[model samples]
Target: MSEHLASIFGTEKDRVNCPFYFKIGASRPDIITPGLDSLGNPIPPKQLQQHFGDLYEDLFEELSKYGEIESLNICDNLADHMVGNVYVQFSEEEHASNAFKNLTGRFYAGRPIIVDFSPVKDFREATCRQYEENICNRGRYCNFMHLKKIGRDLRRHLFGRYRRSYRSRSRSRSRSPYRHKS
Candidate 1:
């Protein structure tokens, strides 16, 4: 994953012209519910899925300002090292680049977000075994996203306004601020 991210975002000296997708790390200890386990250790993965869902919605709305998003997958599984990871795929490389540039190092939920280009080209390839069977024993430890379809009506409405505002902003930027002296 690091290698793929480097290829897309490039090194300090060189950068890629366009990247297809990017991932955001918004995981934080605070996101988990405050509670202790049987051993008196702080139990993680406690109702954080709901928190992640809210984060996803906020991110989707904000990132849409840059461009059209093809897919947004938030990893709900705490198993493995992928918990609290979000992968966003954009229709264009420019959009991905913009999102990467803007979101990297930004704080979310009181934690700094880690943003990087993702090597994943297809989401279906990363499906969880337990999710498909509906018997995920790991529960929160499962390392795959269990997603429900976002309403198309909401998406359409949001994107429509975004496009209009984006166009207007571009137009305004292109116009000259100074007027010819009469």
Candidate 2:
């Protein structure tokens, strides 16, 4: 192996670290946990967006502690593997590794956190194009990531700071952490 490669990947041949890692958190169907409202009732459609916003904020605040997050995404796809998957892209590989190590023992929303290095080099490939245009024929069951939509105000609050730094980087990765808008 080249010296540069050796230094980057480290001597441990078992694990390889990268700038991106995704956490499989409490996967839900269509971004709602259902019966999340008071008295265990289903959240009203009117308040569903608020509940999702709350979730998005909580995740960003918790995950940002590990590093400077470049992007964070939650998959809205209903497929078993893609559902409610939280993908975090850090500015550096070390940050991603730190998060993986630190988050392993932690729990979120009463569920154990599952963190791992991502093989996904491109979100575009995994993204459902139809969903972007709001014309997804497959709905929630699509194999591609159907990312949830977040309120514009909340998005600015969460990602505005990152945007300035991200502009200097690749535009391919500007999108981060939003909720599924119905």
Candidate 3:
């Protein structure tokens, strides 16, 4: 069962590019990746996949410096509005804002990383139910967040580091943390 789930959603060693991290980062603030420019890249297919994994891991580690991440999601939707979107949810609103500010004009894969505040608060409420069941006629074009899954190893490392303090941080509520993390 675990293997099946792992195949469906990559494991840490796999480190495939996940769309849900965009949403996790999105709930805190929407970071839309207008373009990855993967089409023009000269790298081989296998190497390209490795690059993507590195990018996802790199992104998670980079965001960690600003604050504790509650969630990190990326969107796999092909829709213009949802493509290549990465969301990082920091434990605190300030951290989100901080990340948003710093990331506003950065470049990834020779493209600009456009970061902004997303209205999404709860991911459960924002996901497409039909999509989850694999009955969505819309497929990858669904407007709702079709969160991509992360690898267990990467997921464990990204999430496990902060397990001890998650409770203490959540108790102190601040303004809606739905904004671009600077």
Candidate 4:
């Protein structure tokens, strides 16, 4: 590490810290969770652009109607489309709180938005595989045989549970203190 960056990060650099380690709070509000990589590490801003699409703009546009915005982040990593988290820092905590109070459960781009006061949590993946399969069966993105073969391959790849969860093995990594047994 460069001396300048070292001075920025402080000396206890060997240990991994949560992305929020340098932030003010011991625990962040549900508004944001750190974006994660496939191995579940924090992702950079450039990578986060793909996941939430234009939702960030939509959010800021909505929230700015109420107050000046400071920062907005949609936390998704390089792996899947599921949102690992989101973070929005308002100019004032009161604005943040007000945004949370008014926006929670409000619909945005059709789906109801969830406003969280603590660090962001993972949003469940859509079982759109079923829909994808149906579409493939109709020969949209793929054919039935191809989908079946992929399913079979996945099953064989992940201990013979064809239609379970891609996350099954990944979730079993037993590293995070936050990992929950399903």
Candidate 5:
């Protein structure tokens, strides 16, 4: 298999460091179901448990073959929780990177692994760049524009509060109008 070949000819650069892990965003393992209905909706939960169990098993197996398995997480955004994304941490960084490099752009089930180094600041920025490039131009306009508007509104709101606080402090300082009586 590809894995065996990679192991035989793989370099040290293909693996993890002491603190190895990568973050996978915008994926939901919990919502995944066994099959698609006539309307393309996901099948029932019990059916998913029966069928998708093997899929989960295979995923873990693939991960274990790469290096010492530490943790594999899936983003869950049920209830009031704002579960942002999923992160898989290995014992080493190199292992994590290796897994990322190999798995990225590869498809599993119906989705592809979008591997990247963790701690990437501003995912919105990245999406904007990708949108500009017109790489994945399958959908209508993205929600980035809306989110940007929201961010601008938030900034304006914060700025208004900050200006109010600054003005209040300045007024209080001037009202004292008296130098220290030595």
Candidate 6:
């Protein structure tokens, strides 16, 4: 039976780490569990994407402490096998190594996250669709991750300065009795 199992499932040595990228398996807030449904079955892909969003700055900042991140892509494809996977690319191999060491067993959102090195060296090459071209017919079922371009002004958004100013403006407007209200 052991030999039969080995034939069906490859040996543990078949799992090897990639050098440049790190793959993170994390919990989705919308899902009751990591990959399984309430009935212990696998969750569907569309439901996974509905709960997935861009990696917030808090996670980005935490990961940055280990090394400079080149790009972070969270897969939202409607494929059962590829949903909720986060790929983080580091600028240096040493940085990737450091992050892998530190984040392997860390918990996020009440679930332990699984981190492993990925074989993907270039995200652009892995993407099935081009942003500007807008020609990907695969839509939700595409195997590749479709990441939105983060603008250059990320620093501004990260610092809360934008929110502070917006709040001040709103407060001043509320103080004015003459302000038009719909």
The best candidate by lDDT is 2
- Candidate 4 overall lDDT versus native: 0.45
Error of 5 at 136 (Å): 33
Screening candidate 6 with a backbone cut-off below 3 angstroms (N, C-alpha, C), the clashing residue pairs are none
Error of 5 at 15 (Å): 25
Which sequence of candidate numbers ranks them by lDDT, best first?
2, 3, 1, 6, 5, 4
Cα TM-score per model: 0.55, 0.67, 0.63, 0.35, 0.39, 0.56
For 1-182, candidate 1 gives per-residue lDDT tens digits of 88777764533222333221222222233343223454768646534435444566788888888888877776655644455567788989999999999998889768788787766666775656677678877676654554433456655664576578769877876796854442
Error of 2 at 81 (Å): 1.9
lDDT of 3 by residue, 1-182 (tens): 88866775742223234454344333223434332554644666566556656777888999998898888877767765667878778889999999999988998767788888765678877688888888889987777778777668877877887874655455433444654343
Return the candidate ranking by TM-score, descending.
Answer: 2, 3, 6, 1, 5, 4
Against the hidden true structure, what lDDT does model 2 obtain?
A: 0.71
Residue 137, candidate 4: C-alpha displacement in angstroms: 34
Give RMSD (Å) of candidate 1 vs. truth. Answer: 10.0
Better-scoring candidate (lDDT), 2 or 6: 2
In angstroms, how far off is 131's CA in candidate 4? 32
In model 1, what are the clashing residue pairs, if there are any?
77-142, 79-141
Q: What are the clashing pairs of model 4?
A: 29-117, 29-118, 29-119, 30-116, 30-117, 30-118, 31-116, 32-120, 33-120
Q: Is candidate 2 or candidate 3 better by lDDT?
A: 2
Better of 4 and 5 by TM-score: 5
- Model 1: residues with Cα > 4 Å off, grouped in runs: 1-53, 147-182
For candidate 4, what is the total of clashing residue pairs?
9
Locate the minimum summed-lDDT window of 10 residues in model 3.
Answer: 26-35
Q: Rate the local accuracy (lDDT) of all candidates.
A: 0.62, 0.71, 0.70, 0.45, 0.46, 0.61
lDDT of 5: 0.46
lDDT of 6 by residue, 83-158 (tens): 6567787778999999999998899877787787776666776665553367778875565566644445664564
